[model samples]
Target chain A: MSRTTVVAALAAGVLLVAGCSSDEPAPAPSSSGGAATADAGQDHDYTVEGFASSVLGDGTLDDLEDVGSASGEIEGGQVEAQIVSVVADAAGTELVVVLRGDDTGSPSRWSESRGVFTDVRGVEVVDEAAGWRLQPYTILDVSGESDLGCACSEFPYRLGEDGTVVQALLPPLTEGTTSVTVALPGLEPVPGVAVTWR
Target chain B: MQTRPRRTPRWPVALLAAAALTLPTAPAHAAAAPEPGSTVDVAGVDVPVHGTFSLRAAGNASRDLVRGAVHGVRRVEGGTAVYLSLGLPASASRSLPLSSIFTRSRDYESSALAAVTLVDRPGMTAYVPLRGGDAAPYSSDVSEFRALKPGELVVLWAVFPELPAGTRTVDVLVGDARAAVTGVPVEDGALEPVADDLVPQAGEGWPKIAEGDALAGAEAPWSVRPLVQHRGSVDEVTDVAETAEEVDATLAADVLFDKSSATLTAASQDAIARLAADIAARGTGEVRVVGHTDSDGSDSSNQTLSEQRAAAVVAALQPASGTAVTFVAEGRGESEPVAPNTSPENMQLNRRVTVSYQVQEATR
Candidate 1:
């Protein structure tokens, strides 16, 4: 068989396995079912070769409120973002979100190009009276270190699905422990997620 | 402690005699209360260069201050010569070491500890004391390294060449401190006084004026005068003083060059000349000329056209001789338009050229 055909066949086989091993629960079906299919397909295992391993540090995980996962399809593949934790520090409180993407159609493309958090837009957290748009922290280097004389990285991250994971640092939040709604484009709002600080 | 001799091999006593004849004596004006703006610190002492007039004068002033309540300044052949006077406070007991006062770097041509430079100018030029001849019009004493005792002033001098014409005010930078000198009038090959009150008053501190506040309190009468009207259909020049890295000038391409052509029109020539003059009057460094185009043409064609236009501007800015300024050209084509190409006016805004120069303050 031709090289192009061989590559395509291999990509399909990998996607089939990834799609089956997804831990995400099957999304509820709707009359249109378009959004459901897109969300279901995006929940596949994105832990590919070049992805970041963990977004949370050893002890920082205890400070976060797990708000569950949200998914959407983008230009080259599917994107999944999970609002895992929130931590308050001297600078401000931040949302620690883990982001992953699956692109079985072209696994080699992911090998060449790593992920960037700027691709995700319109993600926000809303309280009953006010809403704060989440902006990606962008001052970190490749090793996740902030060179701005700070002890830790202040910027967000973009991770590939090759067994890699990244902790995306969202903008600062002023409200204390409260129920907030997390909204993503083309996905239902995950409401009543408690944002508690440690 | 040793008292160092002021004469050096590079300077001869015979040349000093000739200079004394031509050098203008210090003006007899009563020493006004030290203007807070003229003071700059050197080592641990306060140095103030006196006079409140603009340097944009027609004739060069023979004696000027170099801050620190001492050192003198004057117009020399190629550039300006500043006489550095190192002194100690009267309360001091023994002589203080020169090593503690000035930097001792291998980069300088002289063993002296301190160096002098213009504020915005780049490249580090060592301060060499007067080695005799017509160069040291004010003093024949060569600059040297020596310990200073209480109530004594040690004078050293250095010369800076090729300052642009019509330069009215400039900050004389030494070590980490800078003293602002105003009214050292420019001699444009002839002597004629041009009245200018836009001179900035130095505040009572080192590096007198703060960044982004060059014109903050310049509410003098000259600033409010109406701008001289130009004679063409040319668009007004827009100057935006962004950060130190970005250029402060924006020129509309439509006013400078014909459509689809890189050649400058008569009106454009006038604009470019004024720009070149301004660059010279200020400091010198690397100049970036970037060109942009409207989205009407193909991407590749537009890129090539933009590049050509930027090169044309670089060619026009080349100095006649002995200038440190360098020019570079770049083109962004239709990709980085400042405005949408929906209307004629919007497209006109996109078709323009920007000029910026680098500032080398750290080296000074």
Candidate 2:
């Protein structure tokens, strides 16, 4: 198993610190489930910040929770990802994740197959208490047609220097467990991510 | 060592528990915890097979795991309930088959130390989880154990067919030798809440979200844990499954075909030919070859890829089987999935190829 170094820096700004969890970094995870990290030796430099995102930001914009912004960089120019808000979804456990790829003096491009929409399935969430590590699923229609993509940002475009795509992780975690860890293929494991129940 | 205020056993549950008492060779013993700290060393991993038992018990005295912390085997409405809140030690062996008692046999994985026995009646009434519904029954929850961290705790349960009412004390046999719990109490009462983790979570009611093509489509309960039925045999060597009616062989698409490509893996013809030679002896009629893909790409793309992969397998297997079986190729696309497309293990299972031939009547 290739080791990916995680820059355990807590970034400030739009991201709010979650008071619910321990600051201790999660123990190293087993690489048994990391098929997407096929690029084993790909040198990874990323940051993981776990916090609470309290805002719904729509009609319930005024009714906000602790929805925070954090990012983990797998590659220098690839993208930055974070589990913005993890909520108790009707289906199970859901997480609103963001992947930003807008960096100056680096690659700034969105292809048809690449970027956040396609990479949504690469996000992994784990509830250690429940012994669950949920994989990404493509939500489908009743007729077994793959029309709309998963509950993620579709056809996303960058505004100025900001390139962000939000994807929802459908929950299938056990009912009793909540706090979890989030990680992309090459991303270091981020622990103490809270799950807000709806 | 604390006891939960015992609720008197229910009527039907009591009847079954009492009845089970007759099956065991030894007369029912008083509820007693298995020898605490009982452990078996398997492949250098100290697996916690033995633990405390009964809903009356609170925690296990084992060093490696805290098993059945909440509930033991209890009679529910339809069947007997087996619930466990496991707490693992820092060096606990991380394998599901080593920990949880599955309700049935699984599709793929099997360990030498697999198969936990409800060793109550010795010869007659000892039951393992039922042989599974379909597809060579396999535990769909392998990822949980593999992903287990050091000293982490996870919960698992299975509802087996009810035991006799008199079965107050029973032994939970884990692996080949070790009895996980001895003389565990079997009480009757309300069944605990079922853990919903077995079923992969989906967006409720197929609700369409967002207006874009990349939006989160609704989760339609179409695909299920694919089943294989009736008389069957599994070849762990070549990854083939056979039943009384048909001889079906499964090969992972990952091994047969590379990423997005329909071509077979380089220099892999010898393996397929070896597989063909084995199945040809009993296989008859047309060999139906089907391919499947994971839910990564778009539907149409994955469909095309699946079809191409199927055709590729057919091409490779055609000459190997000789004129005994005609190879027919088709791709069900991403439709039929053995597991949910949510995790690496499940997705790997979803991407696969199957070659089927009717079993010779004489052989059956």
Candidate 3:
């Protein structure tokens, strides 16, 4: 029960899978598993390595703890993240994770520089029991470009003073599941986040 | 996966939690947000407050009807086409934030007000439109939706990946609100292909559901083709998604270049050669090589690096992919990403070189 594994592959030009783990194994990474594999012919360039993994976090949903609203902060150097709320809609699990800075100075000192906070895809929804991670839901324009500015906090993001609130909308967590986890990028996973309904 | 019966009988909040109901822990459901409209339930999904989405109810299933609409959806080869006809009741003068209402894709909250959703109850999965169904400003490039007067209906449709096999009924939600609609059966047969004109607009008057065909020519042709990645085996550097005609291959930037440099790494050459050979066998003629980067550096620098990397890929693949194939290189900075730049694993996907080409032989 201690060393449960959830392996997510980083397929070069092919996948956007997260290296997320929980108490169970991960579901299939992509939608269809019928595409030509590395051994199907073009075996030269297929690589599942050179990952950009979390420097501070290991991206694991440790022990299935149902400690509703564990106030323990997911510390990320200058900035800290806390699960504000978990609102359940029909298919959308809208989570508000407030991020703030402990040591205020220039924004450069913060762990989540500009790169991570700017794009809304930073947050992902992990269904621990199902052992699959859902990508952030994004509203797309005609040309297939996503407009996720409303979903999360915008950057140059004042991670100081009041700190910014990052609202990530993801697919609904599995039914009957009581609690889940939330990890803000470089920060560790905040376990036992309650799934509240309206 | 066991299909639990629909949660139609929702007892009091505290009791329901103690009992066998599958609803979320809504300790705040009865407490915080309470609106005007009475409680309406669809396949166990509680439309929190039915007041906001004041539309008419159809039959026992309570299909949310705005005057009338195409009953079910057109199940196409690529996906399903949902043509909805929405209208406000005569007395209720409501301003529909068109974008907010239908913008609810599989995993997005378009706005705070309401987001549309389609639930495959049996499959226990929710699906948003793969494309289309967005309101005027975004979907049509027309005008932003003005406040819709009563008796006026908006005919909007979107394309979604084909429903899970054996799935018949789907629940439609506009911000947790599904007036009477949910449990709509999947229409029989394939979606009729017409001149794509499923324009999202508030029409002059209400549309009668005289026949349940594809909204009397309210179908959308795929501008964005159905793209699927085959991932049975583990492949690190090259990831590919293919349409019947085009194959889009994404190669890892880490393996291909040094930090901020476009110069192809010596090790990546072998990989490129393999990819080139694959393309040469399948490609008909033209190949577009586009470069992308993760959001780590400044936007300007990322753009420059992406462009340079694309050119390098083109140089590497042009000769190898056959003389008949022409390679063109383009750069999309940190704009379009397959994954969020949150973790290193996600960021690695953003930094890649994508080479797309037409497939001469149809390969699924």
Interface RMSD computed for candidate 2 is what? 26.6
Q: State residue B177's C-alpha deviation in candidate 1, in Å.
A: 36
RMSD of every candidate to native, in Å, equals: 31.1, 23.3, 19.2
Better by TM-score, candidate 3 or 2: 3
TM-score of model 2 (first chain only): 0.49
Looking at candidate 1, what is the lDDT of residue B266?
80
lDDT tens readout by residue for model 3, A17-100: 122222232221111111112111222111111000000011122211222232223333455455666765454465655444
Q: What are the per-residue Cα lDDT tens digits for candidate 3 across B1-364?
A: 2122122222232232222122222111101111222221211222212111222221101222233233335465446655454554333335444442343344322321223345553343455444323232112221334343443444544445567667776644432223223445565443222223333322121122112232222233322223222211022566554434567677899999998899999979877987899777878777998899999999999999999999999888888887658878899999999888988988988999988888775432
> How do the residues B1-364 of candidate 1 rate in per-residue lDDT, one tens digit apiece?
1111111121211222223223323111111122322332222122333322111001111111111322334444444444344334233345655443444434333443333433211111111222212221222122433554443334444444434453443333332112222222222221111112111111111111111222222212211111110011123543333222323467789878899999977878766877787566553677888989999979999999899889888888766212767888999898898767988988998998887775444422
TM-score of chain B of 1: 0.35
Error of 3 at B327 (Å): 4.6
Tens digits of per-residue lDDT, candidate 2, B1-364, equal: 1223222212322222233333332221111111233221111112122243211011111112222332355555434444443333333444333333332234223421123434342111343443232322222233344332333334444434456665664445332212144444565643322224442111001111111122122111221111122111122213443333555667777767778999998645655786677557767888888989999989999899999998988888777676777778999889999877988988988888888788675663
Supply the DockQ value of model 3: 0.03
Candidate 3 local lDDT, residue B350: 92
* Candidate 1 lDDT for residue A67: 72
Error of 1 at A29 (Å): 78
Per model, the share of native interface contacts recovered reads: 0.00, 0.01, 0.00
- Model 1: DockQ vs. true structure: 0.01
